[model samples]
Target: MADTQRTSERINFVHQDEIWKAHVKVEKDSAEVWPRKWGFLTEAYKEFERDSVKLKEVKVTPSHHLATRPLTPPEKYTNVGPSPPVPQTTQALIGWRSAHSRLQLEQHGQVHHGRRSFLKVLGWPRDACS
Candidate 1:
């Protein structure tokens, strides 16, 4: 008997006849500590799209985070309709303490302070701080 192999096909949700290909150029900066890699150039190719209809491409550099992009109104058409509603989220406050601190507090019924002060308060000999 001969072994059979099955080929897998990509299932794209958008069944549009158009196809898009993106090429990216990445650059790594030399650093004595931590080096960060970022994409410098990005080129997009669209199949079946007219060459005259150029898509707006934004090149994000490593320094992009340092400055904010200036907002410009659309030159061709006016933006209409009400803005989308902001998402509502709930925040929670969480805290943690060391087990050793908890143990000392449980055993001595005391809170945060130096070891010497804590011992001295418990009638134990206090050592030189030096």
Candidate 2:
């Protein structure tokens, strides 16, 4: 349908643009901006696609094993030792999810959870989100 068409179009656009980059014919000023503004999306889309396939083989349900567990505050956690820092890409993904959820709540009166919100932002075909 329309969603599939849009996804294909985006893939085609990225492929063609990459070809242009390889040819060294890119407009440098704009080229520098393009990847910074949207590079995570392309990478995220690929990841989402890979995760979707793997998810299909497992039971889909929320786990509450630790929902009632006592939590360590950040101050306590940090005092223990230096933990590995979150990568820039992970930070960006967190920001996107938070912002998207907020926007949906404000505009649509409902929030789309992780997978649907992610696919919606990427304009990918959303088979299901629940």
Candidate 3:
């Protein structure tokens, strides 16, 4: 039928027009714009490098005291053995106790005892007290 043919032709024409408009828009937005932007960034970085060199020349001096102090060797009597492996449950308990002790110290200016003593004071399970 001619009516169906005319409707199909109209639909095809609209679709082709949309595709042409998209192509035109893409062409108008330069394909080289991204490369040009990167070139500008590189030029800016070179300028920054030049400025930094000039600043260092003006401000840097000998005897700037940048060398680190030599580390003192440990005492001969100090124990240097590998630390004992802590169980996961013990580690978690210790971490909790340490955090709690720090908070108590901050609030009261002192904790009653070290980690083990603090755990005992908190009445944590006997196993965790160790």
lDDT of 3 by residue, 2-59 (tens): 6467754545777878999999888777665766756788788999999998988896
- Clashing pairs in model 1? none
Clashes of 1: 0
Q: Taking the tens digit of each residue's C-alpha lDDT, what string does model 1 give over 2-96? A: 21342355546354223322111111223322323322222223332444354435444668678878877695475344433333543221222
How many angstroms is residue 114 displaced in model 1 relative to the true structure, after the best TM-score fit?
65
Task: Order the numbered candidates by TM-score, best leading.
Answer: 3, 2, 1
Q: Tell me which residue pairs clash in candidate 3.
A: none
Comparison by lDDT, 1 against 2, better one: 2
Q: Which stretches of candidate 2 lie over 4 Å from their true place?
A: 1-28, 59-130
For model 1, the superposed segments whose C-alpha errors exceed 4 Å read 1-62, 76-130
Cα deviation of 16, candidate 1, in Å: 96
lDDT of 2 by residue, 1-130 (tens): 6646775444577777788886775567668889999899999999999999998988866679735767878896554433344547865656453454433336546566765477788787778565
**Candidate No. with top TM-score:** 3
- Residue 65 in candidate 1, Cα distance off native in Å: 1.4
TM-score of each: 0.10, 0.22, 0.25
For candidate 1, which ten residues in a row score worst on lDDT? 20-29
